[model samples]
Target chain A: MRIIAFASGKGGVGKTTIVANLGIALARQGKKVLMVDTDLAMANLSLILGMETSPITLNDVLKGDAGVWDVVYDGPEKVSIMPASLGLQDTQRLDLTKLPGIIKQVAPKYDFVLLDCPAGIGEDTLAAMASSTEVFLVVNPHSLSIADALKTKIAAQRINAKPVGLIINMYAGLKGEIPERDIISMLELPLYGVVPYDEEVRKTFYYKKIQPVILRNPDAEASKAVYVVAGKILGIEIDIKKQGGGFFAWLKRLFSR
Target chain B: MGLFSKLAFKLLGIDDTELPAEQIGYIKDISKEYSVPEILKNTFGEFVDSLLHKHLIEGVVVFKENSLIYSSSPDILELANKLYEMFSSFKRENKVLYFNVGSWVSMFEKDEFVYMIKSDTRLCEFELNAVAKDIAVHGKNIFLEEYRKIMSFVKV
Candidate 1:
């Protein structure tokens, strides 16, 4: 089984969203996927998946109260999930050293295991990366974001973690944003895929009806981009027809006229 | 008076009879080679003097390559060595460790280097770990910049 950790240097970069959607996308391709929320301190994967309450969580496993199998919840699209507890006290008593053993126990049951790591290179983030077979860095197009991602790459390299590639999220092609090509060059990592900034993504989070955009709106520009990423991960070429004549495209045509 | 006698009489206000021959011989032997003790004293003395001048630290000790290189207070060397050993073991286990004793907060980096910053100002363990993370991630030059920025805020 291949285990990949989705990590970012800064928060609010859509790391969790990418992991959720990517898991669903991979599951849709007939791959058994396991999505794990390894961000123990601020566990939001459950909230993002509209799973506010779970009978068992990673906290119980870390605290020696429950087994790993007890916390595994069947999420959408045949993706198994292990969500972490939201207790502040649990963060303090967590034994991060046990994370690798925990992942090892369950990794054999799935084709792909995606770990949603916390922001920044803390001990928890290192533990999660150490447990994974490869790491995928998520970053925005801002210079600070790129700088922090470079630091994350360096940290991962120091720990001998294999960095698979870079995922550019929330790309809007806006002014003052760093270009994707430059980000790839500066980070010195291959571009897996770029997910565009879309209004539908905000609506999903705002409404707390967290579902993969690929399944929700397959025609969305962002959804198509995510499918490309998932296809690359699965080593499958999906025939995605380019859909044009959106409002932005129409506005560009009007301006050009 | 002769040159040696004159120098001794002027510096010590004592004749050659008062200065033992062994003591004079020992001084001559020390002057022939570069004195490591003197150099360590002068270098560390200057460092302590500057910190005192700036009122940055009450005492400090430094270790590199598993040896005590410089120290403002000799009494702290034993404790520093112990802490170094502890941090070394932690590094072997792939863990970063930090702690505080009284007014001084100590940070142990992955390169087997330790820094003691004297301040009553409290910083959470997360912030301390973040400092260690930056050093591990960005290398020494960038870590030094971050160290300087932290010192700028904490230095009185």
Candidate 2:
């Protein structure tokens, strides 16, 4: 199995959302994907998947109270998930070192293993990176987020993890936003894909009906972008048609105007 | 006053007649448990809790030896244990571990024991690093004083 970890130097960069949607997208492409919520302390993947409480979580597996296989829940879009415990007290007693072994045990069963890591370069994040074969750094198109992504890249290098590339999210074409080329130059990582800012994504969180954008609204610009990223990862070509009308259609509208 | 008013007073620079009694009581409870100074407890707890609540830093845990002294949230003891091991190894190598991810900064000091400070948002890396250095330089005295206070009340 190809183990890939999605991590961000900073928080609120939509790392978990990417993992959730990308997992679904890959599943749609006939790839068996397992999305593991490795962000133990702030376990939100389960919530994002609309399974706020699971009887068995990664916490149980780490504590030896339950096996990893026992905690695998059937998430939306046929993607398997090993959710983390939501309880605050449960975060304290985890053995993060058990992650690699758990991944090792489950890696052979799936085509892709996507670890949704917590923000920052903390031990939990490092452990997730250490266990994964490749790391994908997620960042927003902002100086602070880009700077943090650079640090995260360095930290990943320190542990000898291969950083696959960068996935720029929340691209709104704002006036002061950093350019994609500059981020690539500074971080020295190839651009995997860019997910545009979409209100549908915000509504997903606001309404608490956490479903993958790809499955919820495939026509959305953000959803199309996510599909492209998933396609790139799987070495498949996803044809996303441009939205605007062709030359003849444009001419007709102009004449009408 | 309510918690929101207190938060507004502190975060939004709003004026209030008095601090929130519930918040103050919560800080006092933490101060009693950790045996740290009330002022320090109140300030650090509020800062850390605000970050966690905002999802800035995933979690923060402080422990001496095997005992957890403080944590920003619950269910993160394993993270603390792993950090302790990693920092302990770094300490053995006569090195400190520091890294900045996004806006978050984490620093580990291996003096008498391992002390870790982690946070993101409202503080840049330079400022957070300065605070970490200060803690490394002078934290032992404060921690020892708190430990002494706690030991005095021990039944054994």
Candidate 3:
């Protein structure tokens, strides 16, 4: 399986959101995708996906009480999520011996393995990187953010992991001045695509239980942008019109088939 | 240089890349965890955290005996490739610069006057901002003469 992880040097840069959306985009392309919440500490991917109380979690798999499939949940767009429990936050750091074996067991089953890593560099973040093949850095267009990203690049090289590219999140077109060139210069990372700041991403978790923003607005700027990146990561050509559908429609078809 | 090579890429100017905030902080934090200099720790942490919060830093790592030991995220690999491209323009001109004057910040003692310079040369960076400053008292020759007159009570 091709494993890709979403990570940031600092917190609150929309790492989890990208993971949730990107996984759906890839899965919608007919690729069996598995989204792993390696951020054992602040296990919040579930909240982003709107499944706060999952039946099982990564802790169960780590503790040997359940298989990886048991903790896996269907995400908004049929993406499989290996969740982390709120109660097992401390287990964020992977136990080396069991990790390779566990990853080996499940890696062959999926086309894409996307890991939602926690914020900051700790034992947990490193372990997540170790399990993946490529890494996607998330950044905001700010000097301080660019500076941290500069340093984060060094950290990645310290370990022999491939730095894939970057995603600019919460992209604000202030007065039509995107500062795209400045950010590109400062962070010195490849510009994959920009995700415009959208209130719908936050609202979907509350009133509507949508699988992903793509299903709601396939043509939305942010959704389209995310799909482009997902397409690049999975190396697949995507036609959004072919994949746009609500959750119930998918459920009905699943039951019928 | 072996230790430097292991970390050369992680630090600013150590390789042909722009150091991400997370990687910078991770290196500093890890270095400090093993008794690295306090100056690097303080400045690096502040700089890295600030960038990270702003989303400038995408990935970071803390190495243990080389290899991809630990990281802020698995995506650090992607950040590295981008950084390689990001700093390529400045790579040829990168250099290790030193300051002759004492630091402008007053938090450090007057006797602790020391030059602040960029240690990383992988990227061509020539600017250094004054992080902090403090005021100090100065006296002229006339003031010294007046002070001597005022010291009449002394056994002259």
Q: Give per-residue CA lDDT, model 3, range A219-245, as digits (tens).
A: 567787798787777667666655546
**Candidate 2 overall Cα lDDT vs. reference?**
0.71
DockQ of each: 0.01, 0.02, 0.02
Point out where model 2 deviates above 4 Å. A241-257, B1-156
The weakest ten consecutive residues by lDDT in model 1 chain A span A241-250
- Interface RMSD in Å per candidate, to 1 decimal? 26.9, 17.6, 18.5
True contacts kept of each: 0.00, 0.00, 0.00
Question: Could you give candidate 1's per-residue lDDT for residues A209-253 as a string of tens digits?
Answer: 565555455667887888899888877786655323366754763
TM-score of each: 0.62, 0.60, 0.56
Candidate 1, superposed: residue stretches over 4 Å from native: A241-257, B1-156
Candidates by lDDT, descending order: 2, 1, 3
Model 3 clash tally, residue pairs: 38
True-structure RMSD, every candidate: 23.9, 17.0, 22.2
lDDT scores of the candidates, listed in order? 0.71, 0.71, 0.57
Best by TM-score: 1
Candidates arranged by TM-score, highest first = 1, 2, 3
